[model samples]
Target: MERVEPKTADDAGARADAYAAGPLLNCLIREVAEPRPDQDGRRVYRLPGGGRLLRVRAGRRPAEPEVYAAGGWRRVDHAELVKLVSDELRRHTGRANDELPAEMIDSRETLAALLAARDAATAPDDPYLRSEQCLVTGHPCHPAPKARGGGPAASWLPYAPEAHARFPLALLGVRADAVVEEGDTSALDALGEAPPGYRLLPAHPWQLDLAAPALAAAFADGRLIRLGATRHDVRPTAAIRTVHAPAPGGDVFLKFSLDVRITNDVRRLWRHDLLRLRRTDAAAAAAVAAADGPAAWLSDRGYRTAAFAFEHLAVVVRDGLREHLRPGATALLAAALAEGFDGNPLDALSGPAVWWPAYLRQVAPPALGAFADHGVVLEAHLQNSLIAVDADGMPVQALFRDAEGVKLLPEVSRSAGLLPEVSRSAGWERLVYCLLVNHLCEIAGALTERFPAYDPWPAVRAELARCPLPEIGDLLTSPTLPGKTNLLLRWTGADGAAARYLPLPNPLAGG
Candidate 1:
C-alpha cells in the first residue's frame, strides 16, 4: 500500500536503504559487466541473480520505474510491481491471505522485514553520490555512460526493464462467428499502418473489467468470442511476458474476475473434484489431528483474490528473461507440483497413499451421501497444471485447467434408483485415465529426464517420511503393479541423446 519515490542518486539510495532497513543476506547487487546510461540521467544496474531489488526511482511514483538490466534499463512501473509481487507471493505461499497479520506474516510483511534488515546492515563508510546506488557495481549512474541497445523499441512494441510491464490486450475486430485462421496478417504491422478506429491502442484494465452477471447469462448465455480484424493469435507462454505502454512507466496486469459464476467454477473444480475426489479433504482433516502435517504446514500461506466476480480470472504483466530453464530446476519444480502423489508405487512396503486408493477412500458412501445426487467430480491430471515460476527459474505455483472431463471415484458403485448409471460409469472412466495414463505418466516422465541423480518417486517418498500417516509413506514407495513398467527414459537418436522409454520399478522400493 505504500509507494516510495526518490529523485536523486542519494535519495534513491536512501529510499532503498529505508525499504531494506538492513542488508539482506540473500540479496547482492550484480554489476552488469557493462553499464548503460538512461535518458533521465540514471545508471541502470542489471542484477542477474539473487533476490528482488527494492528499486526506487525519481518522480512522483513513476507510472513504470526504469529497471536495471544487462542490456540497459527498461521501464517497470508501480502497477507492474503490484502484479508481479502479488502473483509470485501467491504461488510461493500457496495460500491466499493478502493482509498478513503481525504474527504468522509471510508475503508482504516478510518482504518489508527483509528490506528493513537489509537497510540496517548498510556500511556507513560507503561512498555517497548525488544519484541512487547500484548494488551490482557499488556505483552511481555516471554522466554519459555508454549506450547499449538501439533506443527502446517503438511504443507499439513491448519492452520490460524489470520483470513487470503491460501487454497489449489486442481485441481485433472480427465477425462474431469467424474462427481464427493461421498465417493471418500481422496485427502489429496492421495497427502501426492503420488510422483512427483501426489504430492499436494499449488495453486498459478498466475497459475489460466486468461485474458478475445474472445466473443464466454467465454460462448459458455467454457471448461467443469475436475476433478482431487485426488480432495477434498468440497463446500465453510458459515464460512470463513483459510489455510496456507509451507512458514512462506503464501498469502491470491487474485483472479481477468480478463474475461470481467464474469464481464458483474454481471452487467446484478444485474443492469438489481435485480435493474431494481424492479424499484430500479427509487427509487434510486427518493431518491436522496428528500434530503438524502437510496440510497444516501450508495452512496460512498465499496470495490474494479480490472481490468475487461471476466468472473471472486475473493476470499480471512483468519483464524478465523468458527462456528454457536449467534441467535441475525443472525437476525440483515438477516434484513440488506432484506433492508426492503417484498413481503406481514399486515397493509395497512404503506407506504413502496411492492415487487409486485415495480415490476409493474418498468416494465411500459416507463421503458422497452428502452431495445432491447430481453432483460430479473432475480428476486433475498432469496436463491440466500450468506452473508459474519466479526469478530463480523454479516452479512455486500451479493452475489447473480443463474442466469438461469431470467424474466420480471408482469405488462408488452406481444403482439405477436415484443417480443414472451412465453418469457414474463415465466419472469412473475419466478418473482412471486421468490418474493412470494422464497425470502420473506425464509428471513421472518429466522428472525422469529432468533429474537423473536421484529417483523422483523416491524423493517424494523422502518428503512423505515426515507425514502424520507413516503407513501412507510405505504405500507410496511400494509398487502397485506386478512387474517392471517401461517408464524410465532412455537416451536415443543419432548421437544417442534423445530419450526413450525403459523399464523401472512400479513405485520406489521400501517405505
Candidate 2:
C-alpha cells in the first residue's frame, strides 16, 4: 500500500473537501435547501428541514461551507458537513440511512487518496484521454460520486481514472465448449491468444480479484484458465468501468462488469441488459448513422464472457472515439467541459456568440431526430455525450455512446396526465429531461458562467425550433421542464433505473 506522507495527507484532505462539496451542495440546493438572494457576494441558502442557514462561496462548485448558528457563522469541514447533511436529510426525508452518510465521508476520503495518487501517476498525452480522466469531481450531482463501495484504498486506487492510472487487462481463457458470447465480439480474439481448446476473454483485474472466490471453482475444474495480462496498458475513462486500449488505425474500448457500486446501483452489466444490448445499440447506431453531418455513435460492438461466470466476467466492446471523431477535431467528455477540466476549451472561448450555438448545433439535432424519426430516446446526458471541438475550441461534432440507457419506442410505455398539472407524456418528458435538463443545462450554464452577457437559452430555443419534430413547439413554449430529482430518488431507495423528476423553470419560456 502506498502511504501518503503527513504533509501530503493534510493537503489532500483540504483539497478533497472542496471537490467533494460540489455534488453535496448541488443536491442540497436541488432538494432540501432553498436558495436565498445573494448575501455579501456569497451564496446563501436556507436549509428548510434542518432550519439552518448555510452560506458558501457561490458559483458552480460551491465551497467554504459555513452554517449560521447562535448568531455566529462557523465553518464546517467535510466530516461535520457530512453530519449536517445526515441531520438535514433525516429531518427532510423523515428517513435515516445508516449506509449513505458513511459513504459520503468515504467519498471525500477517496478523493483525498485519488489526489495523493494522481501526484505520482502520469496522465495520458492524448487530449481525449485527458478529458476522460480529468473528472476529479466525478458526477456533479451525486452525494457520494467517487465512493468505490467504501473499500480499502489499495483495492481501487490503482484503477482510479482520477489518478490517471493505466494498466493491462487480465486475460483469461475459458474452455471453448463453455464460451458464451453474442453480436460482433470477434474483437476480443485479437486481445490475446488462448490455448487450442479455449477462447480469449479479457477481464478487468480489479473485477477478477473481486470475483476470485466465485471463479475459483471454474479454475479448479479447468473450465477457466489464467492467461496473464494483455500486451498494452489500457487507461480508464471517466466511467471507471470502461477503458481505452490503443490499437492500429483506430483504438477499441472495452467496458467491464464490476460488482462494486459507483454513483448508483451495482455497475454490473446485467444479463437482461446484455441480452437486449444488440437491439438497443443498433437503434442508437442507426439513429446517428441516419442523421446528417458530423454526429456519430460510438457503437457497443458486442460482449464476451464465460458461460459459468456470466455477468461476473462479462466485458462489452465499444467503438473508440478515434473511429467516430471528426478529423483534426479533439473529442472531450461533455461533463468535463461542463464542470471545468484541466485544459477546458470553455475557459478559452471568448464568448458564447460562436461557441454556444456551435455546441447546440452539434448536440441537439441528433437527439431530437432520433426521437422523431427513429423512435429512440437516447440518454444524451453529459457523461454519455462527447463533444469534439475544432482547433478554435468550437464544437464541430457530437459523438454519443452507451446503448444500455437508450429507450426504444416499442418498449416505452406512455403514461399521460399522471401528474395533475403536467400534460406531456412520460416518454416525451424523459427525453426532455435527458436531452435538455441533464445534458444542455449544465453546458449552457458553463457557457453563461464564462460569458454572463450572453443568454444561451435563445440559441438553445433556436436550435430546437429548427428541428421539425412536433414536440419542439410545445417544448419551446412549455411552462416547466422535468428535472430528475436524484437526491430524493436515492434517499427513497428507489431503483436506480426508475427515474423520478420534478418541475423546473423552463428556460425556453423566456422567463
Candidate 3:
C-alpha cells in the first residue's frame, strides 16, 4: 500500500485533487456507529455509509481523518471518513514492517531475491532445506506423537521405520531446546557429511511455543537427547519444524495446519453425508463412512498419515501448472468453442473428416454413460480447468481442483429430493452459467491467445460428442434455453431450421 510520499504543498494538493476525482466522490458518510468486538479481540467502529468495513484501533493517538474541504469541524461524508480513519489508524499502528528491498515486489522478484540471499548467507556447499512444524503437538514433524498414538511407527510420524529405511533425515528442524550445551553444531556437521541433499535450517524463534510440550514429553520419556541451548522463541502463526526426506530432485510441498480438518474432496464427502442426516450422531456416522475410502487407501498404500490426525488432508505438490493459470480461463474457452462452431460439426467444417464418426462411435456415448453411471457432474467449463503443456509444449493433461463445485447426481439426493423448497431453478441456472460462460470462456480465450496455430475447437467438439451434450446448432436453433444462464439445451427436430428461444431461471436465484 506504500506510495510515493507527498513531498511539497503542490504534491499534496495534487493528491487531494486526485482523491476527489476517484470513486469515493458520490459516497456519503452517514455516522460513526458504535464500537463492536471482532474476531481478533479488538473493538472496531462500523461507519454507516461505507458498507461493513470495520474501523481499526485508534488508540491514545489523536488520529484525524483527511478532510476533503478545509472545514474545521463539519459533518464528514462516509467515504472521506473512511480515507481519514484508514490513514490515521495506519500511522498510529504500523502494519507488519517486514519490507523487503524496494526491487523485490512481485512474486517472481521476491522468489529470486530470497533464493539469492539465502544462497549467499548459507554454507556455499550445503543444500537448501525448508521445514515446518504443527502447533497442536510440539513434535518437529507434526500430527504429533501424542496425536498419532501408535508412536514412531505411525504413518505420519516423521521418523517412521519406513522413513529411516529409505529417506534419510536430510533437513531437520531441531527443537531449539534439543540443542544443549554440548552444542547442536556437531550434529549438524554429522548430517552435512552424510549426503548431497542433506541440509538443515534453524527453527524460527516461535517454534519453541509449538515444540515445548513435545520436548517435555520427549525429555520425560528419555526420547530427547539433551544438547546445548535447547530453546528459542517462536510466534504462534509463524511456528514450524521441518525434516527433509533424503531424495534427489524432490519438489514436495507439505502443509501443516494447527486445526485438524479433512480438506478438499474428503471434507466434501463428509459434508454431503452430514446434510443427509437429521440427527447429529447419524451425521457423524456418515462422515466416518465417507472417510473410509481415503483412510483405507492410505493404509493399504503405506502413505503415512501424520501422527496427529488432521481433519483436513494436504495433497502432494505436482507440476504446479494451475498455480500460474488465472481463474476464468475455462469459461472463456467454452464460449470461444461455442462461437467457432455454428452448432453442427458437419455444417461448420468444409473438409471431409473421418474422425467425426469415430467421435460419435467411441467418445460421446461412453462419456455420457460415465457421467450418468458415476453421477459425475463434469462441470468442465473453463475456469475449473487448466491447459498445461509438457516440456515439448504439448497439452498433456487437464488438472481439476476445487471439488466443492462438483455436484453429485440428482439420484444421490435425499428422500426429500434436494430439499423441498430448494431453489432448484436458480441453482441450475448458475450451474449453467458457471459451466458455459464463466469457466469455458476464460480457458478458450487463453488457449486461442497462446496457440493461434492450433485450432482447439475440434477437440472441444469431440468432447461434446463424447458426452450427450445437445448439438450446439440444435440448442441455438431451438427456441427455449431452460435455465436463466441459457445453459440448458432443448432439442427440436421437427421444424428443421426455425427453433424458438426461451429462458430458464437460475435455480439458486431468490424468486
Candidate 4:
C-alpha cells in the first residue's frame, strides 16, 4: 500500500495550507486581482477595489503568498489568507458573506484532516481506486470545496473517498407497494434477497445516517426494512457519491443520494433530477453511440428509491468501464491525470509532441461530434471524463460519465424534451468552460510544465480543426473564452451551480 502521508518536514498543516492556497490564489487572480508589473520572480497583482498589492510565486499552483503592508510585504498564512479574501470580497463586491469566510477556513482544515488521515491510511491496490482517491484538493477552483455541510469531521471523514475509504452500502427492503422505480433497476435485485414482498434498495450509509430520523416512521410502519450491508464493499469513485463495485456480471457502478453539499450542489439524487435521469442518460448514450470512434458514455441504467424517502434513498446504476473500454486498455480519471497520482501517464511523458496530439485526438472529436451531430452538449469536464490508455500509456479512448451534468438540445428531443434545460448558447458556453477551461487547460498546464519548450495549443488547434463541426471555426479564432468566476460567485453568495463568466485569453488564438 502506498500511504500518501505528508512528509516529516512539511507537516500536515503546511501541506494543507499549500494545497488550500492554490485554488484560493487562482480564484483571486482570475476573478478579482489585477496583474501588476512583475518584480524580480514574484508575480504581483493589485486588488481592484482597494488597490491592495498581493504577490506570490506564480504558476499553475501559486505559493508563498504575501500582501503589501506597512512598507514591505507581510506573509499571509492560510487562515489569514481567508480573512484577506473575505475582506477583499467585501470591498470588491460591496457585499459581505458571513458564511463563505467560515467555509473557506473549513475547507482548509478539512484538507489538513484528509491529509493526516490519508497519510496514515493504506491506499487501495487498484490503480483506478488510487486515482479516484487522489482528489484531495477536490475542486480546483471552488472557495470551499471540502466543506461537508459545515458539519463535524467525524461525520464525513469515515466515508471520504480521498482517504481511500471503501465500505459496503447499507441495504433496505422497500415494501413492494412502496417501491418507486424507473427503467431497468433489476441490477439492485441481484445484490441481496429481500424477503417475500420487498424490493432491495441500496442507500449510502452516510445518507441513511443523515436521513434516519425522517425514516423512523417508515421503518416503524414496515414501509422499509433494514436488510444489512452488501457482501462486497463498494469503492467510491472521484465523484464521492458514486461508488464502483465488482459484481458477478463483471463490474458495476452505483451513484447514491448524498444530502451533503460537495462542490456546487447538494450531492443528492434530487427528485427532479432522478425523474429525468433516464431520458438524459438515453440521449447522451445515443449521441456517443452515433459517433464513429471508441468514445463511449457510461449509461445511467436506472434508479430505485422508496416513495416516502424519495430523495434520501435514491440510487442510480451506472455502466461499468469493463464493457466500454477497449481490450488491453485501462481507464483513468481525467482529473487524476491533471492533479497527478502514483502512475499518471502525464508524469512519465517524454515530450508533448507525441503525447499531446494523441490525447487531443482521443478526447476532442467525440465531444465535438456529439454537439455537431447529436445535439448533446456534454459536461465534458475533468471529473466527468475518463481517458482509457493502452500498454504504452497512450490514450486510446475517451469515456464520459455523469448524465446529471449533461445538457440536451431542444432539437435533440421535443416530445421527450429536457425542458428547462440551458439554452443552446448557454449550453455551448458551459461546454466551452467545462471542456476547454476546466478540462483541457489543467492538462495543458501539466504537460506544459514538463515540456515548456513545446507549445501544446497549436496541436490543440489542429486536433480541434480536424473536427468538421462548424463551431470550431469561431472557437479556433475566438479571442477570448469564458472562465467561470468561483470566487466572485461565492463571495456574492450566488448559487454554486449558477455560472458567472469572465473573459480569458484564448490559447487557440496564440500570439
Candidate 5:
C-alpha cells in the first residue's frame, strides 16, 4: 500500500484527537463521573475523584471536551485529555498505570496514520470487504482501541484492515512429525503444496515477522521449512488477525495468532483456547442449528500448527459466507453498520421504524434463543456479528463467528472444574454485556443518530419480551445494565479475561 500525506499535520492531529478523545471521554463518564445538568448544549459530568467538572458535546460520539479549571471551563486536546483521565483514574482507583497513558497516545498517533493511509488507499470493490475495513473509530467504548501495540506505523500499516490492505499469505511447510492439528483443516492444504515429508501451513506475514526470533531454532532444524507466498490475496477483516480468503469453490476465513495487543488482550490464538476449540465450536453450532431462525454460525472448523510453535504459528480455518448466506442477501459486519461506511445498507433507509425492527428480529432472537434453549453463550458483540440484508436493505438473517469466545454453561464449569453457579452467572453476564450493552446499544445509537425522533428501546424491549427466557422479565425491569469496564480493567492491570462491569442506567427499564 502507498501513502500520501494528510492535508496538513495540524488537521490530521486535530482529527485524531477528536477520534481518540471520544472513547476516553465515554469511558471516563460511564465508569466514574457523575452526570450533571446540561451546560450550554454540552453535557456536564463531575469527576468525583477530583471534584472537577468536565463537559463534552455529547452524543453517540462525544466531542469538544472541556474541564472546569481555576475560573472557567478550558478546552483539552487528546494529549491533555489523556493526562486528565490518568490523574482522575489514579485518584479514583488509587492505582498507577504508566502503560495505558502511552497506549492512549499511541492510539491517537495510529488513528492519524490510518486517516492518512485510508485517503490514499483504494477501498475493495466487495461491500463485505469494505465493511470489514471501515472501522476507523473502532470499539467506540475502548480507551485505546486503535493502539497497534505501540509499534511504528510502518510495522503494522501494511497489514492494517483500516488501511484497506490485502496481501498474500506467507506459506510454510511443517514437518509431518511436528504437525499437530484437530478437526477439518483441509483448507490449509489447498493454499499451497509442501514437500513429501511436510504439510502445508499458511501464516500471517505480520505474525511470522513477530515470531521470527522464537522460531529461529525451528527454522535452523528440519522442523520448519519456508515455502513461498500464496497466489491469492487475503483481505484482513475487522478482527485484524482473521482474513477473508476467496477460493475457487467457496470463500473461507483464516485466523492466525497475532502477537499484538489489540483492545483488551494480546490477540494470540492461545494453546489452551485451541485445545478446547472443537468442543466450544461444536456446542455453538448445535445451538445455532436448534435456534428458530435463519441465523447461522460460521464454525471454526479446525486449526493447524507445528507443535513446537503452537501458539505462535497456529492458524484456524473458519466457515465462509457463501454456503450459509441466503441468495440475494448481502452479509455485512454489524460493527460496520454501527460505524458508518460507504454503501452501507443502513444509510439507504428513510427511517429506523422498519429497519430497526427487522434488525432486532434477525439479530436478537438467535443470540437470546441460543442462550435460553441451549447452554451455549455467544460472544455476539458487534465485531463477532454479521447482519445479512435483503434487496430493500432490511435485515434478513444474522451470522455470527468466533467460537474461541463462546462459553458453554455447565459444560465449561465441568470441564474447567469451576462452580456451576459461578459459571452460569458469569456466562449470563457476559452474554448480556456483549449482546445488549456492546452490540445492540451501538446499533441503536447509530439509528438514533439518523432518526432523532425514533426511540429504539421500546422495540428492543418488545423483542426481549418475545423471547421465552424467564430472565427477560427481570432484564426488562432492571435498573442497571452491565457495562464492561475496559478503562478500569486496564488501569488495575487485571487479566483481560477477568471482566469487571459497572452498572449503567438501563433504557429498557422505562420501556
Candidate 6:
C-alpha cells in the first residue's frame, strides 16, 4: 500500500490525534464509563465518575469524541480527552496520576513522528517484515501504547519498528570469565567473532546508548570490549527489543534489553525472568509439540550477557520462522492482521464463512489444547502469536513465542501455594484474556469492520465448543470475559506482571 502524506503540520497532528484517541477512548469506555443509548447515530456513554455524558462515532476504532458541557456536546481533541480521562480516573479510582496523562500525550507525539518517518522510509519487501513493522496503533486497549518513556522522538525513531527500521547490532565482547549465559546461545558466536579471551554478545544499539553510563566502568576495566557492528542489517520487530537478522546459514531473532518503557514497563529482560527461561520455554515447547497439527513454538532457545551488566546488556536468541513455519506458508503477525497493513491476507478475503473457521481452526486449537492437556498456559496474545498462511492466504499453522509470559500450572500453583481450583481459575482467567479477549477479539473486530453484518462469534463459539476442556462449557455460558485493565494498572503503578482484569461482555456466550 502507498503511504499517505499529510499536507501540513495541522493535518499530521489531527491524524495523530485520531490515531491516539482510539485506544485511549477504548480504555476509558471499557474501564471507567457506563454505556448509554446511542445518540444521533453515535454511541453514547456516561462517565459516572465525572458525571458527564460522552459520545463518539463508534466502531472497532472509536473516534470524534465529544463530552456534554455547558448545555451541549463539546468536541474533545486528544489533549482534552487525556484531561477528561485523567479527571474521570482520579474520581473513579480515588487515585491521582500525573504520569499517565504525560504518557498519553507522549504516545500521540510518538505517533506523529512515526507517521512522518513511515512516509519518508521505504517499507520492507518481505511480507513478514512488513507485518512485523505495521502496527501504528499498537495494543488497541492500551492507554499509551506508543509512549517511548517520554524520550525525544530522535532518540527512538531510528530503532522504531513502525518506521521500518533495520540496523546492525552493536557487537560487544565480554571477558570469557565474566560471561553469564544459559541454554543454547551458540547462535551468538556466529553473529560476530570474539577475541580468544572474550565471548561475543550482540546488543541492541539503542540499548547500548541507554546503558552507556552504567557500562562505562566495564568498558574501562576491559570486562567489555566493543567489536563494532554486525555485517547484516537486522530488522526491528513489533517488539522493539527483538530483531530479525537474515543470514546465509539460517535466519535468527535476537531479543535484547531495552530500558525504555513501550507499553507498560521498561522492556528489559529481567534477571528473574531470564533465570527461569529454560523451564518456561521447555514446557511451552513440549506443549506445542504434543498438540496435533502444524502449531509451533518459536522457542527462546537461550541467552548470553555480561555478568556485570546482565539485564542491561542481555540478549535472547529466539528460534526463527523458517524452522517452525510450514514449508510454503507465509507467517504474519496476528496483530498486523488486526491492525491492517499492506498485503494483509484478511483484506483479500471475500467472506468470513470459510475463512473465519479455518482461521480459528489453526489459531485456537493449539492454545486451548496446550492449556487443557499439557497444563501450559500460553500467552497467546496477538503480538506473541503468528498465523502462517498458505499460498492462497488461508491460515495453515500458528506459531507462538515469548516464554517470559508462559505459565505452567504446576509450577505456578506450587510457587503461589494456592488451591488447585484457585490456580486453575487464575490460569484460565489469564488464558481467556490473552487468547480470546486480547488476540481473537481484535482479529474478529477487524474482520467485522470489513464485513459489518457478519457476526464472527458463532464460529468462535463453535471452535470453543470443539475443545473438550471443561472450561469451554463455563466460557460459552458466562456473561463476561476478563479484559486486562492496562490503564488502571499503569495508573496505579502496579507491576506489569501483576495483571488486573475487569469483566467485558462475552460475545461467545448465548450465541
When 3 and 4 are scored with lDDT, the better candidate is 4
Local lDDT at 411 for model 5: 61
Q: How would you encode candidate 6's per-residue C-alpha lDDT over 192-263 as one tens digit per residue?
A: 899999999888989999999999999998999999999989999999999999865678898999998888
Model 4: colliding residue pairs: 5-119
Candidate 5: worst-modelled 10 consecutive residues by lDDT:
1-10
Candidate 1 structure quality by residue, lDDT tens digits, 1-511: 0133245324433344323221110111111112334445533333332233334332211223445457665555323433433443344334443321111111123223323443443321211100011121110111101111112223211212111122444332212232221121222233333333332222222223322232224224333222233232221121112122221232121122212111002111121122122232232223322332111111111111111211222222221112222223221112223322211121121322343233222222211221113233333344333333333433333223222233333332242112231354344334333443344443544344334343445444454343343233434554542211111110001111121222224464554
Residue pairs with backbone overlap in model 6: none
CA lDDT, candidate 6, residue 363: 89
| Backbone clash total, candidate 6 | 0
Looking at model 1, how many pairs of residues clash?
75
Per-residue error for 230 in candidate 6, Å, reads 0.5
Candidate 2 worst ten-residue window by lDDT: 413-422
Deviation of model 6 at 195, angstroms: 1.4
Candidate 2 residue 254 Cα shift, in angstroms, is 0.4
TM-score of each: 0.25, 0.93, 0.30, 0.97, 0.96, 0.96
Model 1 scores worst on lDDT over the 10 consecutive residues at: 484-493
Residues 1-511, model 3: lDDT tens digits: 0111224424423333222211121111211233456424433444443334343223211122233234333334323443443443234334322211111112122222222332333221110111111111111110011222111222232222111111222123323433221111222332232223322222212222234564465446433333332132111111112122222332222212222111101111123322332222222223222321211000000011112211111111112222333333211111222222112122233332333233223222322332334333433443233233233222223333223234444443343355332233333444444444344333343344434464544554444534444333343343433421110110111221121223432222221
RMSD of each: 22.7, 4.5, 19.3, 2.2, 2.9, 2.5
Instruction: Show where candidate 4 strays beyond 4 Å.
Output: 1-10
**Better structure of 2 and 4 per TM-score:** 4
Stretches off by above 4 angstroms in model 5 are 1-10, 411-422
Positional deviation of residue 291's Cα in model 1 after best superposition, in angstroms: 16
Off by over 4 Å in 3: 1-309, 312-373, 378-396, 401-407, 410-438, 445-466, 470-511
Q: After superposition, how far is residue 149 of candidate 5 from its true place, in Å?
A: 0.6
> What TM-score does candidate 2 get on C-alpha atoms?
0.93
Question: What lDDT is reached at residue 408 by model 2?
Answer: 68
